[model samples]
Target: MPAATFEPPAHRGLLTESIARRLQNEIRSGAIPVGAKLPSERELAVQFGASRNVLREVLRRLEAQHLIEVAPGRGSFVIDQSTADARSYDALYRAGRPTVRQLIEARIPIEVEIVGLATSRATDVQIEAMRTANAAMIAATDPVVKARADLEFHDTIAAAAGNPVLRIMLSSIGGMMFEMMLRSNSDPSIAEPGVPHHPEILEAITARDTDRARHHMREHLSLALRTYGPDLDLSLDVMAANHIETLLHRRSTP
Candidate 1:
C-alpha cells in the first residue's frame, strides 16, 4: 500500500493537532490498517511540510492515546480498532471523566445559579468581559474559535458570580465541557439552532434580571440536551460496551 500522506489546507493553526486528527481518521477508516508501519519520521515531516520536532510531538500524542505504537528500531504502527476503543474507555472511566450527558446535567443547575448570581453581582468590568466574549463568539468564523468563545462567555459569567467555590467547580469540568462543545459544533444540524440562545442569555444577564437570567440559562441548557441527547446516549452506550468487551477479552486471555 502507498504510504498515506497528510495535506492540510493553508492557514489552519494547531498544525500538530490537525495532523493527529487526520492520522486518527485514517486509522479509524482503515486506510492505515492495524499493525501497518507508518511512514518514517523524516518522510512524514517532509510530506506534512512540518518540522521534525512538530511531527515527533504529534507522534507522541498519538502514542499516548494508544492510537499508534512507536518502536525505537522500527516505526509507528496503528493499533487494532478494538484495542483503541478499549483504551479510550479505560482512559475516560479511569480518569473519572464524566460522560457528555452527566456533564450537561451537572452544568445546568450549577450554571443557572451562577447566571443568577452574576445578574446581581456583576460589576461593569466583569459584564464587559462577558460582552467581549459574546462578541467574539458572534464574530468567530472558525469552529474552534467559536467554541472557545462560547465557553469563555460562560466562564466570564462564573467569574462575575464572585463565588470562588463555584468558579473552581466549573473550572474543574471546563475541559470536558469544551470537548463536548467542539463535538456538537462540528455538526451543523446541532450547532445552527443553538447560536441565537447565547445572545439571549447574554441579554438577560446584562439586564441584571435574575429570573430572566436563570430562565434563559436553563432554556439554553435544556435546548442543548434536547438537541444532543441522542448522540450523547449513543456515545455512552458504545463506551460502556467497549469497556465490557475489554474486560471479557482480559478474562478470556487468562
Candidate 2:
C-alpha cells in the first residue's frame, strides 16, 4: 500500500469534515490499504492540527459511512475491502444524498430479486431472524422503530442472497431508505400500523417457493407504492410543505 495523501476539499469550514474527506480520498486512492489501522486520535489530531474531539467526530462520520470501524479497547481500523462488502456501497449511498423517490425506485429492482433469491437461499436460522424482525415491526408503536424493523426484515432477505456484494448493496439502500421514509412519512398513522407484507413474504421463503416469494414481493411493493409512495397526493402535510397550497390558492383566485 502507498502512504496516504490528503486531498483538499473545495471548502473546509469544519475540521471533522475536512479530516473525513482527506481520509476518504486516501482510501479510494489506495494510499491507505483496506483493513489498515488508522493512527490514534491524538496522533491524527496532531497531524491534522485538529483537536481530539474533532478527530473523533471525523472518525464517527467515517464509521457511519462504513468506511472505518472503531473497536473499544482496540482501535479504529480501515474496513477490509477484499471481500465484496457493504463499505463502499454504503459510502456511495451516503455521498449521493438521495431523495424519497430516488430511494424507492432504487429499491424496487433489488428488493424484488432479493425475495426470489431468499426463497432458494434462506436457512432455518435466517428464517427465524426474519420472523424476529417481523415480530419487532408488529410490536413497534412508533414510526421510527417500525421503519427500522421494516428495513431489517428486507435486509434479512438480502442476507439470504448468500452474496456479500448483493447483501451490502441491499443494506446500504435499506438503511438510508429507512431514514428517508420516516422523514417523508412523518405521520405514522397515515397507513396501517405495521408492515403488512412480512408474513406472506416469510411464508413464501420458508416454503422454498420462488414464485410465491416473487408474488408476495410484488403485492407488498404495490401496496407500499399506493400507500407511502412519492405521488403528489401521498400526504396533505407534504403538499402543504411543498407549497401545493399556494398553487391551489392561486388557482382558486384565478
Candidate 3:
C-alpha cells in the first residue's frame, strides 16, 4: 500500500497533537500496515504543511505510543497495532492511579539512564538551559514556584537526553512528581538539604561524566524518597478518595 498523506489543520492550537492523532488513526486503521516504512520526515512535513521540527515531535509521540519505530539512519516503521493498543491502554490505566513509591521507583533507573545519556548527548545550549532552570529552582521562594521550577529543572535534563520517549514516560507521572515536590517544599527542613543536589547533578552532566551523573541523579531522587515517601501515603489516600468521589458523581449524573 502507498503511504498515507495528511492535511494540515485549519487552526494552529495543538498542531502537534492533531498531527499525532491523524497519524495514529492511520496506523491503527492499517492504512500504514505493520512493518511498513513510513514516509521520510521531509515528505511528512510537507504533506502536513508543518515544519520539520513539528513533524519530528509528532513522530516522537507516535514512537512513544509504540505506533512507530524510528531508526537512526533509516525512516520510521509501523509496529503491531494490537501490541500498540495494549501498551497505550496500559499506560492510561497506570497514569490514573500512580503511587508515590511507584513514581520514585520508576524514576530511579529512568533518570539515571537519561542523565547518563545527557552527559554524552546534551548540547552546550541544553546544558545552559538546565543551569538556568536549576538556578530558578534555587532562587524561588514560594513553594508552588519552587515546585514548578524543580519539575522544570528535571525536565530540562530529560530534554537534553534527546529521547522523547523517555521524556514522555517520565511526564506520564509528572503530576504525582509535582505533588511530591510541593509536599516536600512546604517543609523548610526537607527542602533545604535537597536544594544543593540539583546543581551537583547538573555539574556532573556538564562534565560529561556518565557515572557521576547517574550517581548524583540517583542520590537526589533517593533523598526525595526518604524525606517525602512516608507523607505521600496519606496524600495518595486522599487522592484515591477524591478519584472515587469523582467517579461516583459521574455515575450518578444523567
Cα lDDT computed for each candidate against the true fold:
0.71, 0.65, 0.71
Q: Write the per-residue lDDT of candidate 2 for residues 69-96, one digit (tens) a residue.
A: 8999889887865445645665555445
Local accuracy of candidate 1 as per-residue lDDT tens digits, 1-254: 12333323321324555566568657766889998999988898888776666678788978877878888998889886575453664344424535667777889989999999999999999988988998997787655577688889889999999999998888766645665665555456677887777778778877878998899888877765777655565444343334333333333354
TM-score-wise, the better of 1 and 2 is: 1
Which of candidates 2 and 3 is the stronger one according to lDDT? 3
Determine which window of 10 residues in candidate 2 has minimal summed lDDT: 1-10
Candidate with best TM-score:
1
Task: Give one digit per residue, the lDDT tens place, for model 3 in 1-254.
Answer: 12233323322223454466567757776788999998888898778776776788888878987878889898899887555454574345343555666667878989999899989999999999998888887787655567778899889999999999999987776755765676566566577788778888888888898999899889888875676645444544344334333433443357
* TM-score of each candidate structure, all chains considered together: 0.62, 0.54, 0.56
Q: Give the Cα RMSD of candidate 2.
A: 12.5
Candidate 2 at residue 150, lDDT?
A: 75
